[model samples]
Target: MRSTGMRARSVPHDSRPVHARPRETEYRPRHPLDLARVVLPQRHGAGDPTMAAANGVIWRASRTPDGPATLALRAGAGGHVRAAAWGPGAEWALDQLPALCGADDDPTGFDAGAHPLVAEAHRRHPDLRIGRTDLVFDALVSAIIEQKVTGMQAFGAWRRIVAWYGERAPGPTPKPMFAPPTIEGWRRVPSWAWHRAGLEPPQSRTIVEAARRGDAIVRAAASAPDADGRERIFTSLRGVGVWTSAETRIRAFGDPDAVSVGDYHLAHHVGFVLTGSRVDDDGMLELLAPWAGQRQRVIRLLYASGIQEPRRGPRMHPEDHRDR
Candidate 1:
């Protein structure tokens, strides 16, 4: 592995204090891999406490199964991904590098040639791949915060919560960052803090509830036989609908077929791109049915194609509920 001389300070969260040190690893993918595309999507926003992409390097902080970790990944010569990690979970994070960088994703049956638009997108970004973090609870918490809110609203709340409750990420990062809160940490966040973070009752309540059942949810998500089975497990919980479940699955498992069926703009965006008309959820599903097993890939391609729905109205105004 190429050396960057990066080091980390381990934060003691377990009974035994982790020796403060840095761990490094490298991975070479067989196919082309767009480091930015695979990693940037995992970040909730530019200000996300747990993720950042800058200067051709991607930094991420997370609560892994083993413990908390901070990871930095950069693309090196010949499609190699160089990863350096810090904190107690550094080894675990290093072990997860391949999956996080899309090693497990296979786009074999996708027929980009079937659609001109898709073909164009595929040509433009042949290296694009869906990446799985395998951090189901983290994805679940972020998805819940995003429910019925604008991206800005959700991102702001996520950043605040992380800053307030999360631990400092152990690394020589460019910016001060924090690992996302542990399951117990999330559950312990006071209701007032959620209010201050701009999280409304429904979203906050759902997150706390989910955190309460975090272990079971994680197990079900990881052990599900198929995407549908996983969806069923997620939707069985309160406040987790198809949209939320799909979003979580997309990040947690790199599931190609999980479409955000009830998204505010996704259906219309798909319709405009595919047929130059606005479409409802049913219509979008119909249009995307041709690519049944790779529906999400189709959406990704459409998004990457730069074909957007024409604006006919002003954007939705953001709401502030801190005083309500």
Candidate 2:
């Protein structure tokens, strides 16, 4: 738990070994909600050891100030979200369920009518809202792993590393899931282990560097006055740039205005969706300028539209750089 500052005691990446009665709670959203739009973005990959979705239930393992927590969230009838959590951080997890499911996202004054396509998308996905995990350190680590790589590579690296080093999630989850290691655990990961996990040295080093000041970093970002403040704090770290900062903001705090500026596919997709032609980052930003405060929300609506630039050639294959 956070102390006078944001300092936390030493602990494992997640829950303690002993099992106990899981904490439970229920949240009824003020607006429409769905696991796909909210919790799904937190998954590193389809087979992420940190998350599992089955039988209308979403299971997630996370690290909190108190400790490791495994949360099982199910959307029940009548817009209710029934949740059960296990581990020391269970209460913390339970308390943040509404934010996790987008209850805290305020889209007031956002004009979907700015563009015809955005309006249509907003109409179709009226329940769409940005979700936040509220775990800054965890978000930073994951964002570091994703830098300058194919999604397949990033996802595979995350899956392998978390499964190998992360703590086993508490409770009877649909599938065995793990939470990413504590800040110390992250530093302790051997160099060879990162190579084996398919993460580049630079990315691994960035994570280590960030973890060195993990608690302080979390405090700074969480307490930031606005998206700009978060960006400044995140970019101040070595090897972290706009893309990583934006991704962290989206996952950790659900900043609707944060856009991953250097993302390879984002500019292309945004340009195509808005102008029927792909554009560079500058062009994409220009098209998105109208919705300055809700750029990410507009992007989400674009994604929801299911339009993409056609692929005319073979998909790029993930490169394996491990010692054979």
Each prediction's TM-score versus the true structure: 0.91, 0.91
Candidate 2 clashes between residue pairs 3 or more apart in a chain or in different chains: 1-65, 14-68, 15-68
Model 2: residues >4 Å from true position, as ranges?
Answer: 1-19, 317-324
Report the Cα lDDT for candidate 1: 0.86
For model 2, the local distance difference test gives 0.86
Report, for every candidate in turn, its global Cα lDDT versus the true structure.
0.86, 0.86
The candidate that wins on TM-score is 2
Candidate 2: count the clashes. Answer: 3
Mark the 10 consecutive residues where model 2 has the least summed lDDT. 2-11
Model 1, 323: alpha-carbon shift in Å?
25
Q: What digit string (tens of lDDT, one per residue) describes model 2 on residues 1-324?
A: 534453122334443355688888989999988666788988998989989999988899998888889999888888789999998899999999899999889999999999999999999998999999999988988888988888988999888888777778888877777878888888878787789789989999999888889889988988899989998998999889888899999999999998888787788899988888889779988999999999999999999999988986898753422111
